[model samples]
Target chain A: MRSKVWVGMVLLMVALLMISGCAKKAVRTDGDVSQAGQDAAALEAEKARRAAEIEAARLAAERDAKRLAEEARLREARNQFMNEHIYFEFDSAALTPTAVSVLKEKGAWLDKERAVNVLIEGHCDERGTNEYNLALGERRAQSAKAFLVDMGISPSRLSTVSYGEERPLDPGQNEAAWAKNRRAQFVVE
Target chain B: MNFSDNFLGGRVRRWRRGFLVLGSLLALAVAVCPSASAADYGYIDLTNPYLRKIPLAIPDFKSVSGDPATVELAREGARLASQTLDFTGYFSIINPGAFLVDPKTMGVTETDVDFKAWTGIGSELLITGLASLSGGVVDLELRLFDTVKQERLLGKRYTARQADLPRLIRRFCSEVLMLLTGNPGPFESQIVFVSGGNGQKEIYTCDFDGGNPQAFTRHGNISLAPSWSTDGLWISYTSYQRGRPDLYIRHRLENRGAVVAEKGINLNGQWVPGRFELAATLSFSGDEEIYLLSGGGKIIKRLTQQPDIDVSPTFSPDGGRMAFVSKRSGSPQIYVMDMGSGHTERLTFEGPYNTQPSWSPKGGRIAYTAMEKNRIDIRMIEIETRRIVQLTQGSGDNESPSWSPDGSLIAFSSTREGPSRIYVMTSFGTDQRRLLSLPGAQSQPDWSPNGIQ
Candidate 1:
């Protein structure tokens, strides 16, 4: 996001510089030998300068709009990567098709952002023993990491941890809360 | 002390546990309990499936000095004695109010007598004691008698600094337990458990009777799965103090420690019996597997190579074998591995979710938690016969079953009464009761040998 904003600012500055250069060109044209001819030339330069400033302003606005749109898209993707947890069924670490698709989308984003690394945290519901759930949580994390690695993300870039039942996305005791809790989550590094 | 020695005559009895000698005092108990000593195997057979709960009476302890200080000390001693014995679940403590004779006037000797009154109250056994306090020191003389046989079973006189009154009562209880069950009761033991609601849990320990509950770790981080080192000087637990589930091996007293902050999860540390070595689950290899670690948290060897998760390894009392939870069999189930040969066998067949296997200190049995239809209960498995016995009825989730040092009882965390709390029951699934009550929730009780030096 920072890089995109930097690019947008750089483009805006370039457009401002172009508009100022067009005005300078118009000023240089004003000192011609014939007054009438020079006035016409100045008039022509002003028309061109006005057109250039208008075009520059339009270009800057377009660039800013594109940058904002791209940023919103990136924000959504990152939010999806972090917030859209790959859920697992109770007492299981196996990935369903839905989980696989989520991992694949995350994989694509990871592919684009080469330098980014992540920690995959596995969590469990409040059932079962805490100690065993810890292992189950780890397995869920590993399965998610493996899916990402299989999708071409470097294994070195993906680390894993198990929170067992200590953490819950939903603290309620019902199935809905439990379904939200039995998941593998991501933290970007 | 001399009279105690004469009554407690005999040599030490050695067992596989190496026995808790407790200096010459415990050594002096053998010559005592003439009626009980004749049956050296112990008056109570703990492993007997049909073992009946002994109906024991603990009347008020007499104050020799009869002053307020001595009187208070005597009353406190009797209360502590009765509470600790009742915790073992081997004794059904008869209410003191039922005694026909006032405990204030009862004598410690068999002749001070009212044996008929005790028998009439259906008390199979009786514990009578007296306390004398002088100059910040207390001397307690306690005796256990068989009401039906009209015989003095065990007697001991313990002297200690006044503040050590609890220790005096605990020691006497140990003596009574030795005569009755052969093994000293869990009175000398401390239970380490995770205490805190939700986040930032810490390791807390209390006496066997839920006395002196204090924080063992002040990490102010999420710490889980604490187990005691064999000698009780060190504690091994997994702490995320550094933002990872790393194994921490710290001394129970002084600020000394070791760490195995491996690449991935380093968790569920279990100390080998009578050794500084421990077994823990590590995922540094990108898969969670059990590995042996030195006391200082250095890796020794990998114990499991299953394709799936293998964790929560509990070693047998002899350290010859380990039973752990593994998903190699498709679901979480208990699996026993021969530590010597590295041969592993699945232990439970009926439950799809059976975990937290605790190897009893005695032998052959492993107690574990089983979950069905979202409810969890504690169950035990016999090694040779593959016998499965449920130790807890399903109520709220009963999880993380841990065995006491004596193996006569099992401790675990239960959510039966709303918020979770630590609880214990007889090994045969009787006398279920909450072990302690604290402000916050507590779970994962690991009963260790005496933790204080």
Candidate 2:
């Protein structure tokens, strides 16, 4: 009887040990799968972060390029306006046809911009009396102002003044200087 | 008590005392005198060529009404004339009470009046007048007599409102000066000067008396040396508007202008007569030289042979001769040249520097700036005799003397006020006054032609 009882106890102990070993293997497998799932989630999150960073950089570059292009266009327009001068005829307060054309083009540009206030400066050649020349200069400025107003620019936006014989475009006493002096200059304020 | 006898007795006593005092003083001074028989005439020796004053007598004009108000008006007119002449620094008006003749007794038509009376009173010139209120206006008849010459020099009738008596008196006095000195008066001329407003020197026009000034050039550019055209229609000036010194002409009536010349320094331009020629200083030849240009901006001839500085040319009334300042003689001096022959003659001596020669309209003399003995002054040179009469003295750099149309006075620029201001004085260097009291520095005063009515 005692021998049979010992055999039963040993068999029970062996069965219980095998069952605990299987449970341990199942728990180890569950931990490894959970850790692998966490690693995969971290990798996918890193990929999404990198994609978002690239997209932000690309948008910033596009915005910078757009701003530079706009600035370039503005610079070109300003340069064109700055380089053009209004010329006049000899001893004439009246504007020449070419001066009228240039003024028209400038007026169109100003129309597009609408916020620009210009100063019309009347100049004269160094050949007349100072008092009389001043009066002539005022007429030249008025001539330019009249044209600008006719082209739809508001009269208040234009200011006319005579430099008289004070300001000359050329310092020579030759025809070249008189030609340069007979002009109305447009300046952006 | 007899009041008249008592007053007479008192006056006799005072006179006796005054005579005793005067006698003793005279005796004491005569003991030390260089001559024992020196007369007691109150006269000052004018040994210096630059005399402080030439004694003159301008008495109250005899009024017809003899009313106190009329008398006062006549006295005021005479006083105005005296002040005007005195301001010219050439005349020292003697008081009538200091002499024997009463100013009330003198008349403008009394040509037989004793010049000995004025000479006895040590007056070199005697001016007398009569004023009458007729037709609701003041009619004044003035007479100027050279007591030394013993002849009447000026006689004129002027009619003006009673209120304008002061100005009329000044104008009449200036005319008298022209008759005596042979130069035009600057009283009625105009000057164009530059003033700083809004950070730029703008051109402004004012009367030679510094009245009725108006701003003409408003462009914010540096204005310099605004010269008048002979016709008074245009002004040629150099402006920095184009970033270089360019020549420009401003027309009078149209308020329009044009560039006359360019590409170098074109400056100091004066219009030649008939609106056909312009004389200007051009630096196009790498240095400043006088160039003659057609009215339409074509170079006709070069006035100066050397590339030295030759500027500020003023033509005679007939345009036959031009007076210019040249630096060829190692210093700036006035030179007169025949416009047709180009024959140059030096007109100034006794000064290291002389510039800004202005030919008198009558062609008798040239007015210019002269530096003498470390002092800059205005001097007039007789064209034929080369006699230089210094018109100004002291430590002021009086420059740019412009002759009046009638050759009586000169309008000039001086830097006595820390900045340049225009001044008018007699050709004798008297009666200087500040004209055109505008803000900023005003200089380069050019008198206009006769704008008289």
Candidate 3:
């Protein structure tokens, strides 16, 4: 009877040991699955941060290019107004309708830019006395300035000078040369 | 010697002639009955200053020998000599038809020449010349005799080409004038200026009396205010070719030119002795300043470093002094500068604006433009004498008076018409005439020497 009771106790201890070992193995597998999920979450966060940085860099480059293009366009427009020279008639200080039209265009440009100063240079052909031609040239320049003043430009932004017969556009003593000489020109400062 | 009341270019011819004839008869009656009183001083004063025009007789010229060309040249010489003395307004030419001694009978070299016949024909001065052409060259021998003194005043012989007969004549005439009045003749000289109206402003040159107008420059740029060198071979002018103003030297002999003031604004350059220094209005400093530059384009000196407008500088005949127009006085006025001392003196005080001063070659007179009311006229100021002579009386805006080398005429630009034209007049401002008819305008007349030859 004593030998039979000892075998029973040993069998019971082995069964308990097997049950504990199975539970421990199941817990280890669950830990492994949790570690794999945490690694996937870390990789996804890194990919999202890199994508956002690239989008911001591309937007900045596009904005810089657009600003450069805008600056170039302004420069070209300013040059167009300054490059042209205005012409006038022989012995006539009166501005023609065509000259007025041109001035209007110039006024529009000035209004848009608002930083340029216009210089009205009064010039005459080499026909008249120097003193008289000087006076005539002044009159022509004043006339042009008056036109500009009437066009809503500030009078303070304009200046006039008369070269008289001392300056001629054409050195030839012919009708063609005189016609070219009788004029007032515009310069921007 | 109140001869007649009739003159050319006058009005009321018949009425004035009758009135003057009646008045002259009454004055003669009164003169016979007048006592030597203060009221009679007027008649006596007029009689005391009895200056009469001296009579001269010019023959067709006596040719003793030489080829046809030689004879032709001799006659031309005599004709030119006669014309020169006659234009002085001092001598009168006796009619050739009134000659008592025929040239065919009496020789020009006669020692016992009959002075009685010439005197009776109202001749006080006599000119004779003989010309010979050989090897395509002309040898001209001329003689001038004061008939009253019966002494030869001049006996000059010259050699030139056959084509130079006219010029030779003019020179001989000028010599006679020099002997009579210590002043040289301006006939052989030229006038340079600018003309406009037809459609262009071109520099034109002509004789002192507005004859032989010729155009010299044809740059598309504006050309004006041509000043001549003492030799008249080179012209200093302002040109606007590089879009900026610059001075240019044009050599008529070489037919070549270059910009002397290349980098700065240069206007109205006149020549000085031994150097090409000019008084130019420069903008190198961003404002118009007067600078003195060497002929080689070196900035030798700066006359005015201020910012006011200064232009139109004329050097005195001696080149020791200069007269220029300056606006430092708040308006344009004539100013004089002494070169040695670098001192300046204001010369003009009359007009609201007096500019474009041209110093006479005699160094005595300053010709400038003075404002008259609203018009401008040419005026003269005698430096030593302080004598003011108002030259022009026209309504045209006259400016830029360029005196002849001989100081007998002035060429200026006027705006009497719609455009400016070049005009020549006596220094006294009596005779006026236009030189160009091109529909385009012309201005700035500068006289050259006998350079075309």
Candidate 4:
């Protein structure tokens, strides 16, 4: 802190000397003028070096912030892939038009991010028996996978599982909840 | 609550706290009118199923050595025997308050029970138990006496450790049921089921009548569809422990097992009766198809060729035929395929959705779940006659019908009281009662024959 203050003071003093030298050229001695000129040159070099260092630190900080933001954005993208589900009708695994659109987006995302692998989980409403629901859930998951493969995602990168009615997205025993529970969910592996 | 405590017509006074505690289990104490054939002592009419529950009397058990510990055992033994017998949906227990004589003055033998005292109280049969404890071992003798004829129908003696009293009593109950029903009842059996919800499900097993329920798998992940091997040694189930559905065949007692973690879903692993192999739904072939897998989970052969979903394979008692659910005909229906010829035929035509076919051990009927007006119920289809009998009705969906080892009872799961729980009823759907209550819902019950080693 003291050195920076000293440097500022020196620069101010040199500026005053130059201003005075310009105004009173006849009163200044030759040796005094030469010393001031030498000091000015060295001060110019120090100022340039400090400006360069400040610019480098600013660029470095900006790059680091950009990298962190990109990482967070990728994490959010993965989360969106896991949460967007393809829903089905009662006791049926046939994909709806809305479900197909959602799978289309999923396929595009998977295609853009080639390094991703996912496990598609098939689920069911609490209406059917667990054994049948398990099989139905698997069928639903396979339905989603088939559509994604049709949209150009590698079948190898996509796996499937069936939670049956074991894990319900909504525990409510109503129509709305049952509709929500009968879905195909994605889990990034 | 003393005289008419049991709808079966008999109850003992002060059998202990456990009696009153378990006495509430008289939920199944059905009002079977007294049988008219009480004169035919030692004879059971198999043709007349669901006959009146035999009016029975069980006196307080006595200790031979008069040891305090043995006396406690005797009391518990009597209560347990009576409770187990009551669970058979037989023996309307007669009240001991109406007994003409005290049990302490009589020996636990056919000759000691006074015929006039019991016959006068409407007791058709009676059970007398005696216990003796020595060096941490208990000697128990239980006898079933025909009070009408004043003759003993069955008698057995067993010596076991203190903790094994339930097993000993079950052995005696099996004897009693053997003599009465021809086939021993489910007293010697156990039920494996799925319990727990809210994103976690695990496998559980309990003795018949819902005693000693404990978690069979600690996977802490979603485990569904537990199938007990007919040999009573292995339990096959599907667990999500490895993050994907895999079929796990684990020994009931040992610490070793095999897993089929094939590429896609490995749904339900059902063991072939009396064989070292199992059938499971594997999707590695790009579609859900049933395949025969070795007991160690090695794929032996693909059993089904279909573009539609075909899963849940159940073999007949003789392994000559396999029954399963398929969507080959545009809707979910059950189909049976002869194992020898691989010829498949649709066994159900009444459904837009019919699945979960459980082949009865008796080999003539296959019990399955059917949907009627959006409500699920258990229905049995006789193979030869194509007679479908609706076994469950008017309760919150009752599905997953598993036949007891004797085929006289069907154990299933229902949501009649809200959360799904295990329940049992006669094959005729009479005397419906909750089997057990656990934290979280229970489903997918599979009964094993002779739960004891």
Q: Which candidate number has the best DockQ? A: 1
lDDT of 4 by residue, A140-171 (tens): 99999999998889989998888888788888
Worst 10 residues of 2 chain A by lDDT: A126-135
Which of the predicted structures, 1 or 2, would earn the higher lDDT when compared with the native?
1
DockQ by candidate, in order: 0.49, 0.04, 0.05, 0.43
Clashes of each: 5, 56, 35, 8
TM-score for chain B of each model, two decimals: 0.88, 0.64, 0.76, 0.87
lDDT (tens digit, per residue) of candidate 2 on B56-106: 888788898887877888999888787767655556789767766777775
Task: List residue ranges in candidate 4 displaced over 4 A.
Answer: A1-80, B1-48, B65-68, B451-453
Q: Rank the candidates by DockQ, best first.
A: 1, 4, 3, 2
Instruction: Please give the lDDT score at residue A122 for candidate 2.
Output: 75
Candidate 1, residues B189-238, lDDT tens digits: the string is: 88999998758899999888677899988888899899998788888898
Residue A97 of model 4, lDDT score: 97
Candidate 3 positional error at A9, Å: 99
TM-score of chain A of each: 0.79, 0.68, 0.60, 0.76
lDDT for A125 in candidate 4 is 95
